[model samples]
Target: MSDRVRLKGRFIKKKVRDKQVKAVAAMREAHLSKNVPRSPPNLKFSFDGRRIVDMQYLSEHLKCIKCKKDIFLRNTVEESRMGLNCILNISCEECSTLTRVHTGKMHGTGENKNRVDVNTKAVLGAVHSGIGETALNKLLVCLNVPPISANLYKRYEREIGPAIEAAAKDSCREAAKEEKQLVIANVDKLCQEM
Candidate 1:
């Protein structure tokens, strides 16, 4: 290996050793059953509201969709959408999923709405590509139900679309307003307590 590669590897190994020690100590303090931190890590992101959990904490909590095994996000890919820095991608051991993190409670509604939109798009794309219908058929077959055709899938979308959009919009607005009020109230309370 090149000198640079060797030096980088050594640095990473040392960092990993230090982190492992800290993690072990934290786990011991929290009781051995909990291998992760009880309190969220000190991490700040602009879009993430005050109530948002740190990425480190989230990474600790994330589980693989397939195996349901705990996984860690090793890298983050950032992207700008709606003029915010969203976590566009993350790399984990088993699989990677797209993520969008918003900072502070004030933005929770907006964040939730964004999540809904993303989920809707994902589902729609799956359906359009026949993946969702095929998967549904497989599931139905397991339950001994009749299979469905792609043409009939539009009916499902039509039935669900308006409700989903309305609910998502309402939820987003309500959440954002509520979170903003809560944060302001907390700040006031903190001042009074101090």
Candidate 2:
């Protein structure tokens, strides 16, 4: 190996040894888990949201936007309870995207300012089924999910709209072609009878 490589290896070895020494000293002074601060109980966030469990469970259902690959939630850096809301910063293993999901509770005010986590599947599914924004919003509100804004809904529609339209058009054309062929076959039999 070159001198630089040898020096780097030696430096890493020294750092590891120093860390081991520090850990031993810290353990002697106090317990490892006991010294760690506990997060407040009132925090609604349980990793993803109020309903979500660990990072593993959340990651299983989420995908990376850029790579279109399964995204894993890395280590939780910080978790804090600001009143009823839980502020969490979780890192992504695949893309290294830092996602912040804050579980917000309804304050004394009438409006909700918390960013609601909407399921992408639900939104896309409803849009595919030709559900309008107003109706969809009402349905979501009834189900206790925050209402999606019209502008945001339109933006989502714009993103996936062309693909959806093409698929629908293809299906319609196939159906029409089949119906025309069936009609022509029946008409030929009638003409032969005449």
Candidate 3:
């Protein structure tokens, strides 16, 4: 064969190999995505001595404060300067009741206050404990407060709060594993090409 013809054939072969690698990489990524678990909700909380203080993902059975029907209860955690607080919203499929629970810590003064007030730190703390950073940021934006950074948010996640941190960590680990699998698959394909 002529030199030029040989060179052309070699170039076409390389192009075909490259295309195959890309196709394989794309398929591997898709497979990884399918295997990956959905990211768990970051909202997590536990209860205080007598009250359901932390409201994130809490499941309880109670009489709906509004309709008075026995229903499953769920509370969302919210954040404020003082810490986390829970906002209880009870539902029975047909009706719902909303109530706010405070952790007693107040912002600015850091003093314990009457838990009945909505703006108290205890309430804010309960709210903060329940929601993840993304939700918290959205809530803060809605309330016209500055959004907290993710690093600061992580610190808050590690600090004194609900015992639901385990679920959050498991979620993060699962995501990381999915990402790592993608990386390894791509690397293996590249090595095969060489």
Candidate 4:
């Protein structure tokens, strides 16, 4: 079924290279040349914003766990935020696999679920500072960060408040025992001298 030409007593195959294909290839090359790789964003580390980063901004820099290829920000499925913790559910561009990436390391101390330690600490800081929810929210706003709601703060309060109190009580008891021991030793030395 080839396009052949008979000249004299021989057949010459027709050239398949067309101008349209060459034009298309040239256009493709030009388009590809325009898409130069961009340099990664310079991220500054801050105590308040240490673990959390904008996922969409860092998407191009992020590699897929499944294929070890690049993941695009456009394929983002969900951006879940819990106080200072953030988890991005994104799909891989090459493998189409879904992966969940956390903004900060999980605490692994929760009884039911593992959450970021920063969140618990944030709540603790608020409670310990006697600022409470409203004040904590104001501070976060001043820091230009998301606010931790009163409900979440209360949830953390219920979890860590008892522990904090118990720790303080134990520390006081230890200090009292040490002070009594010191007084007894001083008295014993004085008696020995007499």
lDDT for model 4, please.
0.70
Against the hidden reference, what TM-scores do the models get?
Answer: 0.30, 0.41, 0.20, 0.57
For residue 120, what is the lDDT in candidate 3?
35
lDDT tens string, model 3, 61-178?
3455555655543333333332234344332344423333333332332332322222333224645577567787677667654555676556444443444566678889999999
Estimate, for each residue in 26-45, the C-alpha lDDT of model 1 and write its tens digit.
97877863443234232332
The residue-level lDDT of candidate 2 at 79 comes to 68
Model 2 lDDT tens row, 45-157: 33433332234435444554444565333444556543223445654455554455443322222332332234334457778688888888777666654566677666555
Each prediction's number of clashing residue pairs = 10, 0, 15, 0
What C-alpha RMSD separates each model from the true structure? 25.0, 15.1, 30.1, 15.5
Stretches off by above 4 angstroms in model 4 are 1-65, 70-77, 108-111, 188-194
Model 2 lDDT-worst window of ten: 106-115
Q: Pick the candidate with the highest lDDT.
A: 4
CA lDDT of each prediction against the hidden true structure:
0.48, 0.54, 0.48, 0.70
Candidate numbers, best lDDT first, in rank order: 4, 2, 3, 1
